[model samples]
Target: HPLFPLLALLFEKCELATQSSECPSTESFNLDIQAFVQHQDRERKPFFTEDHEVNDLMIKAIQVLRIHMLELEKVQELCKDFCNRYITCLKGKMQSENLLRSDYGGYDSDDSSSGAGSAAGLPGIPPPGMPGGRHSVPPGLIGGPPVPPYYGHPGPGPHHLS
Candidate 1:
């Protein structure tokens, strides 16, 4: 569990940020990263395996974290960004697994639906006015309308856009 410390730090920071509705400074995060790096160097063991898909997702997550650290340096926002990215990653992973299962004729309807629901529900989206606060938009959607589930889709119901 070489990554345990880093993951714990991320969860703790994200919880605090969500609870307080404020981003914390990046000082502690930086320190934790440095510590993690030093530990990895000392251990001199391979951290990543040959699982390319999982490896790619991990790389993407790290890149997203690094970008936020450099640009925002706000723990709260960083956590939000990271969490959103993470949800995307989970969705991708689930989709891939479903594809594999389908190919093998082992697809499980229960698993796929539950996986999708879990990923979707994890964010517990904030309301519109809470943008950049508890209800902040994902970074890519900043300055844009709040992205409701049906944002771009036309519907047949009363909620349909004109």
Candidate 2:
């Protein structure tokens, strides 16, 4: 639940970038349309026109198409870059969450240890009940003497407290 806002923001940014990149610039579109219309108009003209004029019209049309093609390629590149960044962001978030869980003694749901000292497997650490481990006995109590249970009297009997 806490990650909702961050994920929402990320998605929003991705959507905005995609929309902006996918939509061709209005000015560029208008220019392309104008060039195409002029080319068509030139073709409809009288056949008596000079050969050089027809060649110039053909060249202009080719140039306009090339420009449109380049713009499409640029938009495609932007989309690819955006997708890569989004995937990286998601990976970073997942790694951070795992680190937080480990720090707080939370084990992965798939782990078989059931929240025991999973750190025991790591280097420079000891296992449970071993020396310097989480469940290890203090040095002073290690094999020193046997502790006797007190019955509140020398002989074993139910004694009343006065």
Candidate 3:
């Protein structure tokens, strides 16, 4: 009976709370509460309309969630596109290898002696003087005389390897 004003005030406050994009100012809060309370009958009014407040919040929240969900879906689609492109590129490279192998009289790709260092048949630039092992033992594999280990101690004996 006497609580009508109180219920209206609460309803007003909640309604105002939903209107502002940010927190309601103290004035706004008071005004809202007052507005809701005004709607209550003079003698008595039921609790502030829970249905209205809930409906408003639910709608706003759903909109925000939908926007976010769409953004995530877009990102997912882009990622899928990227993955597809990468797989296509890989497949193309593999196809190129297959075509090359077919042309090479069924040579297995592991036939390193036939082409591994040949960069798919492009002219290889020889490094300066020694000119790509055309002279003397290859850099890392100098097999001539047994040179002293002057470089430094050969570290502790190898562990566990046969």
Cα lDDT tens digits, model 1, 2-66, are 45456667656655645675655667667777877888889895657677777676656655665
- Can you list the residue pairs that collide in candidate 1? 132-136
Q: Name the runs in model 2 displaced over 4 angstroms.
A: 1-54, 105-162
How far does residue 62 in candidate 2 sit from its true spot (Å)?
Answer: 0.9
Off by over 4 Å in 1: 1-5, 65-162
Overall lDDT per candidate, in order of appearance: 0.58, 0.53, 0.49
* Deviation (Å) of 13 in candidate 3: 31
**Which tens-of-lDDT digit does each residue in 90-123 have in candidate 2?**
9999998778677654542323344333442343
Write down the TM-score of every candidate: 0.35, 0.33, 0.36
Query: What is the alpha-carbon lDDT for the whole of candidate 3?
Result: 0.49
Q: Comparing 1 and 2 by TM-score, which wins? A: 1
For candidate 1, report its TM-score. Answer: 0.35
- RMSD in angstroms, candidate 2? 21.1
Rank all candidate structures by their TM-score, best first, as comma-separated numbers. Answer: 3, 1, 2
Determine the backbone clash count of candidate 2: 0
